[model samples]
Target: MAGWAAAAALLLLPLFAVQFTDGVNWEMVDFSVFGAMLLGAGVSYELAVRMTGSSAYRAAVGVAVAAAFLLVWINLAVGIIGSEDNSANLMYGGVLAIAVIGAAIGRFQSAGMTRALSATALAQVLVGIIALAAEFGSTAPSFPEAIVLSTGFFVALWLLSAYLFLKAASG
Candidate 1:
């Protein structure tokens, strides 16, 4: 119930922001997409909690969900590597793919989650390196620096999630 309430509050936030400023404009499609993402994250976390009795495992699930949510939100709102229209931004999807595939392969167990998230973090780093070397979104706003910072931030999130899962497995 709290998760559902939080989702509703977050969904309404944009509506309030739009009324206050032009900078916060959001169409129906934006609302729909964000709502779907939030719903999926909430559902996924709920299921994960059911699968684990460990607090560390639950925290890991929260971190993983939050990381995935932020990645999609930022990538869609404004291109991470450039503008939303930039083709380079699509590379970030690979990172999400790795996480998804890894999670499935690991069967959502703590040990498996640890490996999955660590691999996801490595994939994030590699994507950042490749984008920099290839100059994928050179024309986008904050081009190089923003890309570096975003990559670092996401990598850290993945690592943190992996560490939590590892702790859960150990404990």
Candidate 2:
């Protein structure tokens, strides 16, 4: 209840800003989506906490869920190192979507964990490569080093998550 209330309060912050100043301008749809994302993150972490017994697994679950929420929210807000509408950035969402769906499909078993983690890691790589390609194809005059760095950063995170899952599965 505290988590949900805190998330709700955060979501309402922009609205309060709008009432007092012009600096904050967010549409209803923006509020709805962002609110949903926050709520979803809280719910996910709560579920992970309830379902997982191992501390390592719980930590991984917490991080992975938070990462997915952040990745999606950032891409939706400002794109993953580029324009928000850039299709190449959708791969981040794809990685997360697979994580959820793959878990369900695998019945949350050890072998399934391995496959799902590997798939997510692969998706992260694909996101980086595609984002790089998208940047090159754009008519924008100069390349942004930040884009490359961000992609590399995310790829490393996914790889680490995969390794964690593999270790958990083996143990």
Candidate 3:
């Protein structure tokens, strides 16, 4: 109930913002997508809570969910490689696919989650490197720096999640 309420509140924020400022213009589709993402993340965390008593495990789940959510949100809003329309942004789907597939394979166990997140971190790095090599966003002023910085941020999140899961597994 609290989670659902929080989701509603978050949804309402944009609605309110739009009324107050033109900078916050959001169409129906934006609200729908953001709502779905919030619901998905909430459901994921709820499931993790039901599955484990370990705080470390729960924290790991939280971090991983946040990372995934942010990845999608940013990709859709502004595209990692260039504009939101850039085809190169599609490569991020594979990074997410690895995490989903890995989690399913591990059955959400702490040890398995550790491996999954570690693999995810590696995948994130590889994707950034590939983008740089292929010059996905080379036309942009930021280019390689933006790609490297964003990739590092995500890699750190994934690594932290993996570390938390490792702690949970060993605890």
Count of steric clashes across candidates, in order:
0, 0, 0
Tens digits of per-residue lDDT for model 2, 1-171 = 887888889888988997999877888999999988997899877886787676656666666676677788878887764577666666677888888887778676545755776677677767677767666325433246656666667666656666666666767
Off by more than 4 A, model 2: 16-23, 134-142
**Model 2 quality (TM-score):** 0.78
Model 1: CA > 4 A from native: none
Q: How close is candidate 3 to the true structure, as a TM-score?
A: 0.95
Q: What is the per-residue lDDT of model 3 for residues 47-160, given as tens digits with 9 covering 90 to 100?
A: 999999999999999999999999999999888897778899898999999999999899889999999999999999999999999999888887878899999999999999
How far in Å is the alpha carbon of 58 misplaced in model 3?
Answer: 0.2
Model 1 C-alpha lDDT versus the unseen true structure: 0.93
RMSD in Å for all candidates: 0.9, 2.9, 1.2
Regarding TM-score, does 1 or 3 come out ahead? Answer: 1
Query: Which ten contiguous residues of candidate 3 have the minimum total lDDT?
Result: 77-86
lDDT of each: 0.93, 0.71, 0.93
TM-score, predicted candidate 1 vs. hidden true structure = 0.97
Ranking by lDDT: 3, 1, 2
How many clashes show up in model 3? 0
Per-prediction TM-score: 0.97, 0.78, 0.95
- Clashing pairs in model 2, backbone N/Cα/C closer than 3 A: none
Evaluate model 2: give its lDDT: 0.71
Q: Which ten residues in a row have the lowest lDDT in candidate 2?
A: 134-143
